[model samples]
Target chain A: MILAPQALLSAQQQIQRDLHSCLDYFDLPHPLKDAVHHAVMLGGKRVRPALVYASAQLDGDVMSAAARRAAVAVELIHCYSLTHDDLPCMDNDELRRGQPTCHVAYGEATALLAGDILQSMAFEVLGSRMFDTADLPNPAIALRQMQLLATASSKMVCGQVLDLQAEGQSIDQSHLENIHRNKTGALIQAAIMLGATTVLPVAHPSFTHLRIFGQSLGLAFQVQDDILDITADTEVLGKTAGKDIQVQKSTYPALLGLDAAQVYAQQLHDQALEALQQVTGNTQPLQDVTQFLLHRQS
Target chain B: MILAPQALLSAQQQIQRDLHSCLDYFDLPHPLKDAVHHAVMLGGKRVRPALVYASAQLDGDVMSAAARRAAVAVELIHCYSLTHDDLPCMDNDELRRGQPTCHVAYGEATALLAGDILQSMAFEVLGSRMFDTADLPNPAIALRQMQLLATASSKMVCGQVLDLQAEGQSIDQSHLENIHRNKTGALIQAAIMLGATTVLPVAHPSFTHLRIFGQSLGLAFQVQDDILDITADTEVLGKTAGKDIQVQKSTYPALLGLDAAQVYAQQLHDQALEALQQVTGNTQPLQDVTQFLLHRQS
Candidate 1:
C-alpha cells in the first residue's frame, strides 16, 4: 500500500509546478494575484492533486496535459473551498497550514474575491486551449470534467451550509454522514472521476469502481481528520487544533466514541481498497493514496 | 428597433420556465432549494436570456436545447452575483428587483451558499445532458461556451475586487473603466458571446462583431445604471437610490457632470449600434435590447 517515496515526491513537485503555472496564466492585479498565490502555493498536502495524478496513472504512466490540467483544476477548487471555509462568515479560523488564513493575510473582501476568481479559473483551465496537447483537446471530456467539478463543488457548498446549520445542534449519525459526504466526499470523488474521464470512456466499468473507491476514501479522510483534530496539537495539525470543539461542531469522534471513529475510518479505508478490486490498470497509486489518507497526521 | 411586444414577452416566459425547470433538476433540501429559487425567480428582467434567444434566432427560428440552456446558464450566474453582492460583507443592500434581497429573506450563510450553488449550477447546466440535442452535443462548443462564461465571471469578480478597493479612494477614468469592465461589462459581453457561440463559429466574422457590440453595449449599460442611480427613486429603481453616493463609490456622474455623463452614455450607445453593422443576423433584438438598457429605470 506504500508508495515509493521518491516517485511520490516527484509527482507532488510536478503538481506544484503545474498549479503555479496555471496561476501564472491569469492577468490579475497586485494584491489579488498575491492572495491567490498565497492561498494556492502555501504549504499543504496537495492530496486532491495527488489523487488526480494517481488515478490518471491507472490508465498510463505518461500523463497527458489534460490529466495535468485536471490535477491543477481539482487542487484549485480545493484551495478555493479552504479559503472560503476559513472566511469570517464560515469557519473563521485565523490560521491554516500553520500560517495566516487568506482573509487574515489579504483583507476579507480580497480573500472572498480571490476564492471566487479561483473557482472561475479552475473551470477556465479545464475548458481552455491551454490544456490541449498533440491529440487535440477532447471537448466532450472537457465538458464532462467541468460538469463533474461543478457538481462536486455545489455539493461541497451544500455540505458547508448543512454544517453551518448543524452547529450547536445534536445531529444524528446519518445527518453527519450526509454533511461530510457532500462537503468532503463529493470533491474527492470528483477528483478521481475527473482523472478517469481523461483516459477512459464514460461508460467504462473503471469509472464506476473509481467513483466507489473515491467515495469511501473521501469519507475515511473526513473521519481521520476528525480524529486528528482531537488527537493532534496545534503545531502538528498546522491549524487551530481543538477549534472544532471550541465551536462545538459535530464530528465523527463526537458522535461515535474516539475508538469507534478510528474503527469506522479503518472500515471505510478497507471499503475503498476493496472497491479497487473491480478496477483495472495500475491501482497501486490509488492504494497508496488511501493508505496515506488513513495514516495522515494532519 | 423595438421588438414585437408579444414576441419579447413570450421569450421572457420561455426563459423563466426553463430556469425554473433547471432548478427543479437539483435534489437540494428545503430552505436551500427555496433560497435558490427565490434568488432566481422572484424578480428582475430577463435581459440576458432575451439576448440569447435573439442571437440564436439569426441562425434559425427553431431554438435548440443548447441555446435554451445557455440562456438559463447566463441568468444563473447573474442571479448568483447579485445574491453575493447583496451580502452583509458586500453592498449590504436590503432590496433587489423591488423585493427583499436573498440574505434578507434567508440568513447570510444560506444566502452565501445559495449564491455559491447557483454559480455551480450555471456551469452544470452548460455541461449537462439537458443541453444535448439531436446534433449529439458538440463537446467543443460546450467547452468553448464554458470557457467564455468562466473567463467573464472571473473578470467580473476581479472587477468587484477592484471596485471594492476603489471605494473611498480617488480613482481615475481608466480605473473606473477597469472596474466596470470586469464587474458588469464582462458578464454582459459573455452573455452575448455565449449566444453567438451557440450559432456561430469561433472564428466567424460575426463573432468578432458581436463581441465588439457586446463590449460597447456593456459599457453603455453601466453608464446608464450610474445615471439612473442618481436620478431615480428607490421604488422606481427597485433598489436603494443614491446609495452609490452614500458609499462614496466613484461613478460616471460623479466624475463627469450629469449632462456630460448622459452624453457619454449616448456616445457609447451609438458605438454599440455601430458595431452591429459588421454583424449579420436578425439583429432587431440586439438593437431593442440596447435601447432598453439605455432607457431602463429599474
Candidate 2:
C-alpha cells in the first residue's frame, strides 16, 4: 500500500506553509526569527507530521483547521526535540540532515533560545483556535490536543533521561524498550491521537485501534533507525554512520543481530497493519507511512 | 499596602503544595523527578505565584481552582526559565538561592531535560480542567491562561536572545527597556493577567488598567533586580553579587547610576499603584504585593 507520490508531497507542502504562518507571528526584528526559521525550515523526513496527516486524511483533500493544527504542532514538537538533543551537553552533534545543527548554524545561546521558543510555540499554536466556528471541538479539542501533546512531551523528556542513564550500562531488552516507548513511541501515539481527535471524539472506538497501530509503528520506526545506523553509510544516513556503535549506545542490532532486527521490524510493520484493519477509515495513508518507516534510508 | 506576613506565608505554602502535586505525575522511578523537584522546590521569593493569587483574590481568601492553576503555571514557567538561564551556555552561573544551580547539582543533560519537562508540565497543568465542574472557566479560562503563558514564554525566550546579543555592547535606555519588557516584564505581566483572567473575563475593563499595572510592575521589578545586583552582598543575593558588572550585561544600575536606578524603581512602583487604583476590586492584595516588590531587601 505505497502512498501515491502526490499525497506525500501535498502533506509536505501543507506542513511547510502552516509552519511558515506560525513563524510570521515572531517575524519582528530579532536573531530568534532567523534562528527559528533555520531550525524548522531545514528539511527532514517529516515523519511525525506525516503520521498526523495520514491518520487524519479521511476527509477531503482540503485539510480542516483542526487537522492543520495537529499537523503543525506534532512537527514542531519533533523539530524542537531534535534541536535540544543535538546540544553540546547532550549528543554534542554538529550536523543534522547533512547540514549544520542549530547550535552550529546559530550560536549555542541562540540555538538554546530557539529550541525553548519552539516548545512554547507548539502550545501557542494549540491554543490559537480562538476563531473556529464550525463543529470543531472549538476550545475543547484544543485542550485535549494540548493535554496529549504535553503529556507525550513530558514522557519524551523522561525517556531521554532514561536513555542518558542507560548509556554505557548493561541493561536488558525490556529496559531498552522502556526508553524507546517513552522517548519515541509516546509522541508517535500522540500524533495519531491528535489527528483522530481532530475529527472524532476521544471516546470513539477508533482511538483504541489507532493507539495499537501507533504503538506498533513507533517500534518499527525506531528499530529501522537502529538498523540504519549499522547498515547504511554516512551520506545516506544524513548523519554520521555507526554513531550508535561509536558512542556505545545500545541499539536493536547491538541487542539482537542485524538480520534478527530486520525481521523484528517487519514483524512490527505487520502488527501495525493488522491494528489498522480494526480502524474504520481510509487507512491506506497510514499503511503507506508504516511501509515508509520500515524502508526509509535516512 | 504591604502584604500581611500570614498572607504571604500562605501563598508560599499553597504554591509549594501545588508544585509538589504537579511533580507527582513524573513520580515514577527516574532521576528526572528528583532533578525537577530540585529545580522547582528550591526556595526563591515565590513572587510570581504570589502575583497570581493576589490578582485573583477578588471574592474570598480561599483560591478557586482557576486561580490555583494560574498560580502554578506562572511559577512553573518562571522556574523553567531560571533553570535554562543557568545552563553552561547561558548565564553559566553555578549557584542560585544559596544552592547549586540545576546544572551544577544535577548533570547538565539532566538539568536540560528537567527544564524541558517543567515547560510541558506547565501547559499540562493548564489543560488539566477535565475534573473541574465548577463555574471556573471550565476550559475557556484554561485556554486563555495557556494563551497568556505561552505568549509570555515565547516573548521571554526572545528577550533572552536579545539580552544575550546585547552582552558587552553599548545599548540605549529604550533598547534595555525592550529587552526587559520582553524577557522579564512579559512573564510578570502574564502572571498578573493570568490571575485576573481567572476571575475576570477577557473583555473586563479592569484588564485594561491591570495591563498597565502589570507593565509598570514588571519594569519596576527588573530595575530593582538590577539595583540589588550592585548594592546587595553575595550571601543576601543567594547568587554572586555584582554578576551584572562581571558579565557587562545591560542593567538599570549600569545604564543609569545606582541612585537614579533606585529613583526609577520608585517612580515605576508609584505608577503601578496608580494604575491599580483604577481597577474596581479590593485591590489591596495587589497593592501589598506591589509594595513588597518595591522595598524587598533581596
Best by TM-score: 1
Candidate 1 regions off by >4 Å? A1-4, A131-136, B1-4, B131-136
Show model 2 residue runs off by greater than 4 Å: A1-4, A59-61, A129-137, B1-4, B129-137
Top candidate, metric DockQ: 1
State the lDDT at B112 in candidate 2.
88
lDDT by residue (A1-298, candidate 1, tens digit) is: 2344555667789988887788888889878999999999996888888888888888778888888888888888999889988988778889999999999999887887788888889999887766454554688889889989999999998898888879899999999999999999999999998888877887998888888999999999999999999999999889999888899999999999999999999999999999998999999888887777888778
TM-scores of all candidate predictions against the true structure: 0.96, 0.95
The candidate that achieves the highest lDDT relative to the unseen native structure: 1
Q: Chain B TM-score per candidate, please.
A: 0.95, 0.95
- Model 1 steric clash total: 0
TM-score of chain A of 1: 0.96
RMSD vs true structure, all candidates: 2.2, 2.4
